[model samples]
Target chain A: MLRFANPTLFLKLVRWLLPLAGGAGAVLLAWGLYLVFAVSPEDYQQGATVRIMYIHVPAAWLALSCYSLMALSSIGSLVWKHPLADVSAKALAPIGAAFTFLCLVTGALWGKPMWGTWWVWDARLTSVLVLFLVYCGIMALWTAFDDPARAARPVAILTLFGFINVPIVKFSVDWWNTLHQPASVFRMGGPSIDPSMLTPLFVMASGATALMLALHLAGMRTEIMRRRVRTLSQQLARQDGGS
Target chain B: MMDTPHAGYILASYLLAGVIVAGLVLLAVLDDRAQRKALARLEAQGLRRRSSGQTGEQ
Candidate 1:
């Protein structure tokens, strides 16, 4: 793992892993969607609306997972000062924001038909909104600084501060009385979902995870190249100034 | 499910997710190409990265 701290070595690894992850993501998503529509049974109450869960649940899970990843990378940036750590964290912001946005939108879509409203100020819902806002804030912070190196420490600090929301977002469903259902797939008593539905949900989650990984790798590669460009341009400026 | 009463909502959810995912992929790919091009242009201009040898072939 430490071997990956070198950006060049990391890029070499990404060259191979990116395509593999993207391919696996595509295949798994295709298979998962097939099962979602044709194989999984509808909820006795929600009917076809339950089909939305196939995507919603996975998006929700990924949103939380993405933040957790950012927090971990932020730690690396601050503690170990891993060179690729800030790059990894920076790259993940927009992707994590996208997933969080998807989760909210899908949840709203699912809500309208089932709850008869587009949104509510419930604990689970509101905390996720806060999570989305944090993602946006981190992205903005990355852009606020002209120098990537200068931005790294502050961004990592903000990320760690924002991580308080992760546990809040996860446990909100249980900690408070909310419309969102509590822990269907992950719980002390094991999953309450039928195997048929559970299978597709897990498959979709895996696919989304793979796709996120590919995107993050691509983002990191671009960031590394970007830093190099900045350095070269600075060097050119210095040379012109010297001459 | 397309014919179901809530099909529109279901469709919208999936469609929106698709669009967002596609947008992210496009951003990653385009940003990558742009940076690579900028690096090539800089190198062509006789500017070499200070750590060029250590970084290996990108």
Candidate 2:
């Protein structure tokens, strides 16, 4: 892993991997959407509206996963001073935030019909809401300081602190009596949902994850370039003043 | 118009997701290009200054 720490080496690897990741993501997304629209069975209880889960659940899971990833990477940045780690965390924030927002909105959409309300204070929902706020706080911290390192320090610490909430969000349904449904797909036995629905759900979940990775890597590349430009511009100004 | 029970909810949700994802991707690409250009320009300026500095010293 550290062998590719050199920026130029990393860039070359990213260049080769980008097209592959992006293309696979596109194909998976297309197939996933096709299955979602045409092949997957509607819920016996919820009817056509269950289709929203194709996008909603995946976004929710990805949002939480992305935050956990950012927190882990932030630890590396703060402790080991791994250059790419901080870049990865910084770049992933907006995309993760967007996913979290979608999860909340879509979950609300699903809830209004299924539960007869637009919003609820269920443990799962409330925890996810806190997760979103945590993301927002990290983003705000990133810009609150003029010194880049200082700005990053608080975010890193916050990320590490906030990760404790992820597990609570994940298991809130099981841990506490809640409106949210218990785990169906990830259980000791197997998915309780019919295979007809599970297939497309898996496809869409994979596609969404690939899409997340593609967006994240692309964003990370841009951040690397951005920092490079910032450093270079400062050097140029310094040289000009020196002479 | 597709008011089949909860169709409006599903449609709205999908639309929002699409808009957000597409907007983010476009912004990422734009930022990448902008940063690369800025770095190129700065490097060029630095090169010019270093060359001028050498001449002044001689």
Candidate 3:
């Protein structure tokens, strides 16, 4: 982990990792989609609409997981002041926001057909919505500062503070009466979902995780270059002024 | 599956997810290209980074 703190080494590593992750993601997603349509059976209660769970559940999972990654990166930024950690936290914000948006829209699409509505102000739904807003806020905070370094601490602080919503979003269904279902795939008693559906769901999730990693790696690489550009331009300006 | 009731909703969900994911991929790729271009232009102007000795191309 500490070795990766060096930006040059990180860039070299991502050069290979990005393609590997992207290729794996493409393959897994294709395989997962095939299983979703061909192998998984329709739910007795929800019928064809249950198919939405493959995409929706994975989006929700990734959204939460992305936030968790950001929060961990934020800790690295604040506690250790690691350079790559700051880049990671910055890079992940938009990706996390995108996934959260996917989760909400897909959840609404699933809800309308099955639950007879587009949305409900339930604990789970509302908390996820808050999570989306927090992502947006963190992105906004990033742009608010003129210097990326100046932005790092504030963004890290906001991220750590916003992490309160992650567990709330996860456990919201259990803690409150909500339209959202509680812990089907992950529960103390083991998965309530049948094996037929669970297989494709896990495949889709693994695919999504791979894709997210690819995007993060690319984002980090870009951010490192961006900082380099800033530094080079400043140096050029200084040389001109001194001349 | 297309004949299934509420298929439009399911299709819409998948379509939207595809669009968002593609958009993210596009953004990452474009940003990377742009930064690389900027760095190259600066380096071409003979303004090397102070730490250029320790690092390769940005």
Candidate 4:
């Protein structure tokens, strides 16, 4: 991680990893889908509807985890002045927003059949909705400012401050009175969900994480290039401008 | 299982995955090309400035 503080090394590392991550993400997702549909047994009660969890739950996990990653990177940016950390967090917002949106959409689909409602204000659901909005606010703040450095301060503060919500989202179903179901995968004793259902869920979650990594890397690369071009253009403008 | 009849959920999940993943891959490819092109332009511009500077000295 420290080695990447040097831009030259970081660029080289990203160059090699991007293609590998993209290829691996594609292959893993294909295999994961096969396992989700063909191999995993259908739920006795929910039937094929349970299959939504394969996508929904994984996205929900990533949506939460990505924000944490962003916050942690922001802290590194502030404390250690780690080069590219802020840029990394800034790049992650849109990807996390998409995952959060996916989670909500799939959750609603699952809810319509399972809970008899498309949009319940369940504690878990509402908290996650807020988390998604927070992601949007962070992205907007970063782009709103004319100066990138000025933008980083407030955006980093907000990203770090919002770290409080990650645990709340994880425990909202259990902590408050809500219609949403409690933790099944991360409970202390064991996962309450049966193995038939759990296997596909794990496979899909793994695939989703890989996909997010690929997306995050690709987005960060674009951001890096954009910054470089902006710098060059600014220099060119200064040289050509009249005295 | 048979009585529930929930193929719609499965279809939706597959469709969403296909759309999102394909869209991301397309963006990555296009962004990579755009970045490379911009970099090339900057490099050419830099070289042009240096050549002009050298000719002015001569």
Top candidate, metric DockQ: 1
List residue ranges in candidate 4 displaced over 4 A: B1-4, B47-58
Candidate 1's residue-wise lDDT over A1-243, tens digit each? Answer: 778778888888998999999999999999999998888888888887888898888888888888889999999999998889999999999999999999999999999888999999999999999999999999999999999999999999999999999999989999999998898888998999989889999999999999999999999999999999999999989889999
User: Where does candidate 2 stray beyond 4 Å?
Assistant: B1-3, B47-58
Q: Write the per-residue lDDT of candidate 3 for residues A124-191, one digit (tens) a residue.
A: 99999999999999999999998999999999999999999999999998999999999898888999
Question: Which of the two, 1 or 2, has more TM-score?
Answer: 1
Q: Give me the overall lDDT of model 1.
A: 0.91
Candidate 4 clash pair list: none
- Give the per-residue lDDT of model 4 (tens digit) for A93-128: 988888898888888888888888888888899999
lDDT of 2 by residue, A1-243 (tens): 787675556776788677788788789889988888878877778898989988888998899889988988898889998878888898788888999999999999999999999888999999989989988988888888765656677788889999999999989999999988888888888889888888888888888888888888888778777766666667777778999
- lDDT per residue for candidate 2 within B1-58, as digits (tens), equals 2336788898898899889878987998888878877766766664333222231110
For all candidates in order, the CA lDDT equals: 0.91, 0.82, 0.91, 0.79
Can you tell me which runs of candidate 3 are displaced by over 4 Å?
none
Better of 3 and 4 by DockQ: 3
| Colliding pairs, model 2 | none
The residue-level lDDT of candidate 2 at B10 comes to 84
